[model samples]
Target: MADLEDEPQAATVAVGSLDDVAPPPRQPPSEPADPAAGSLERARELLAAHPIADGGSGLALALREAPLYDIEDGERLLETDIPRLRDGGVGAQFWSLHVRGELTGDRAVTATLDQLDLVRSLVADFAEGLRLAMSAGDMADARNCGRIAVLLGPVAGPALGDSLATLRAYHALGVRSVTISGTRWTQRTGLTPFGQEVIREMNRLGVLVDLSGCTLETMRSTLVAAKAPVVISHHPEPVPDDVLRQLRANRGVCMVACTGASIRETADRLDHVRETAGPQSVALTGAYDTGSPHAPGLADVSCFPRLIAELLDRDWPQPDIETLTWTNVSRMLRDAEFVSRAMQARRPASTARPTPLDA
Candidate 1:
């Protein structure tokens, strides 16, 4: 995949005096709508009708960009936006704390912390509907309690600079996953000697390594180095067999992104990967969020059920579908927490940070 280049600017609309143009006669009927939308709607209906068969237990999850911070002007989460996710059958979401690559050193760290504060405030403001979930168990608990479990992830490793301790520190502060690079390469791109150290540290800390926007080389190197399962939080393109084989060998999952271009062919690619790599290797993510840099297509969080529906239409088995929607992601997260907890148990009390569960 190419480094995410500067997106071509949106086409500007020209404004002119309406009085200068004459009124048209009758308009022709609109063309037949694509079946995708209707199929997606049917999927939503299925989710609503069935309710995941476990009360949102093992229900859908979305790797959404940070909604609270990225909201358009005059938008509010509690009053207006979050309900859409609720309506979309989203049981959990990984809200990103994206620090741009340009913000190096303390600026990046400070910005990440500020976003953390923003996320915390969101949980507080929407207490009944949201909860801060730092582990897989916490996520399940939040779902069981009928609240959407909100988890923290930061896009790009620049927020950590050159500090391995900073990665651990973020884990202590409830960051469960992190993207190693963004549109640009991070300080440690996993292709360098120091980058390997970063990957190993992330594995040791049980922080899920995300290889979303990194270079192919970075993805390969990181896969080799990471002891824990990794995820491509937003895979905007298809991978060759070698990459799929490597991901399978490393027990990683790629959250197939749902942008305009990515969405159209996602199912076909997903099928090919499943056939080549196995069912455990793929999951779903909607990176073309309201704040997505990609051109608009999939509208919002609501597009998820539609995606599920699309797969269903193709006769994907329910079990395989669950693996695509939930099980793959759930397993990765649960394993990360298991490793973390085991490590914490072995560590001396002086070295271990106090976890919420222990409290």
Candidate 2:
């Protein structure tokens, strides 16, 4: 299978959750106006009636106008994303956060942060239509309220300024999970070193470690090292060579079945990881396209849930299910707040200034 090294410039696979991405610069939402507001409903209807994808504005145009986000209209992203999948049920979200990794440096970080800030802002702006899901239970809560719960994750974790330390800080910024690499070898735990330290650090921090965007060597090394339940967010994990044991099925590491050209490798890897990780593993599918191995090119607002549904078709191992969908990812977010409290205790009152950003 082609690894991130082989396809550095290839379009990024789905991120599934925006739990660990730094913010990117903002590209205005194709339609910032809420459909529920004044003439918005009528305007939205007219726009949607046409070939709709990016909030009814067309995917190309939305992509041109917005950066980082796959869908065009921020307002309709949740509205359109949830209904496409069978596995997703009513509340499962494979939300992903990503940016063009080739575009690196402070500019990338700044732009990524912009995207993150925009997501948070958009949540409030589209409060009636969306909710950010931090835990498995939060999904149910949002569904009962008829709202889509947004998951914040990074398309690549190493993009956060090259240190696990930086990732810890991001957790404070409301990030819930992180993909260690995205379509390239990175400095810390990327294809270069296998990122074992990165994996261990993430497990300890409570951030869900994503194993997509890695090569067999990179994935193998990191997976072997990662102890907490993990999610291979979008790609299928190929079966390991006899040398490697597939403990994922027993360890309960979560695995998200993804849309890609190599579905079999993905599936095999999923089974291997589950066999290696066991019971705690989980799988998620991409609903953006017809059920096929071809990667889901880009996400549209209405088709989000299709991704969820596609994964549900398989007999999801029970242990993998809870860890993937709710438990492991949930711990990443909730625990950060607890850590923040402890950090505050160690510092002198004067060193830590009172501010809304403290948490």
Candidate 3:
């Protein structure tokens, strides 16, 4: 994989005036066909064959605020509900287990555990609609059974309290993904030596690395160091084109957030990422209940079909759409699991401790 120094900068676009352009001859106006009719149907058909595997969400945080909020009820709470998830064709969702950034040490770890418990409780309470998934196979099985798979992921590295043993403990508790940066701990230094160890441990445990808020430097370093594929979950800003290109070599996926002024804008962002990095490296995240405003048409999780229809109208290939909705994330998880099995067989769990430099 190319390092940050070697990656090319994004090309700039220049605008030109149309002062010298001439107008074409006018022709008779004709009635336009309703393009949405055919495209919407096609989008739904594609979704039935391959449902969405959302990269991340903040519904758990919302539940933390209103413990009484019941997802089983037909009423929508924030951006998700049982009915809306079904309407949206979401087969698998990674509910972010995020705590306040101010909380640290034992307090952070404990709060994260509480968030995990809350997610598990929600899945158990709504057993008919939700199923806890720990592996890629589990996600597929959930979809096959008509239940939404719930995968757990911490929003930042601080949730681990700087302990690899705690990392293992969380994995035992069914945490499948961890964001290695994006917190105050590593904001200044990027990925420290200790962060590298965390990535290796995550690889050994089959936990997915999420570079949601890392700097480009950190992302490039992690890409070169990681053994398995990584993910950038729920990034609102456009991922730099250079990073998208680097993903081609690392086999990582950049999940486009569903937060724009309109569904059309969201589709345009997806188009840009797909064009930059092949369709195999692009995916979607509803980014629901993260306290961010969702797009007008994509106000809730039920609006995913609208975006898909837009893509279909733009003539996106069926296979490429399928890869965006499901194949990429599923393949990434399976690859992580494959790497874990091999690493575990070759070596033991890392016992290295953080040094003063890592701080």
Q: Give the best candidate by lDDT.
A: 3
lDDT of 3 by residue, 1-359 (tens): 56986988886545566754556989989979778977777777888889999888898988899888768875665788988898888999999997887888788888899999989988998999999999999999999899999999954688777788988999999999898775443545467788888889999999999888888788888888899999998765778998899887788899999887888888898999999989989999988888878878889888888899999888899899999999999999999999999999997999877888776
Per-residue lDDT tens digits for candidate 2, residues 165-280, read: 56666666656667766523333333443254455555555566665555666566665665555555554344344313432431323444444554444455445555554434
Q: State how far residue 97 of model 2 sits from its true place (Å).
A: 1.8
For TM-score, the strongest prediction is 3
Task: Rank by TM-score, highest first.
Answer: 3, 1, 2
Per-candidate TM vs. native? 0.72, 0.54, 0.89
Candidate 1: tens digits of C-alpha lDDT, residues 1-359: 24445666676546888776667898899999878777777677655533221111101111123343422222333212456666667777777777555787789888788777767776787778878887778877887888877777744577875566777788888887777774233323335555665665676677898877677777888778777788877655676678788989877886665655544476776788888768898876655332444223445565567667768779888778777766677788887767666765664322222233211
Error of 1 at 344 (Å): 5.2
After superposing candidate 1 on the true structure, give the runs of residues whose Cα lies further than 4 Å from its correct spot: 1-42, 45-80, 182-190, 261-263, 288-290, 293-297, 342-359
Better of 1 and 2 by TM-score: 1
Task: Evaluate model 1: give its lDDT.
Answer: 0.65
> Can you tell me which runs of candidate 3 are displaced by over 4 Å?
1-33, 183-189
10 residues in a row with least lDDT, candidate 3? 182-191
What TM-score would you give candidate 3 relative to the actual structure?
0.89
TM-score of 2: 0.54
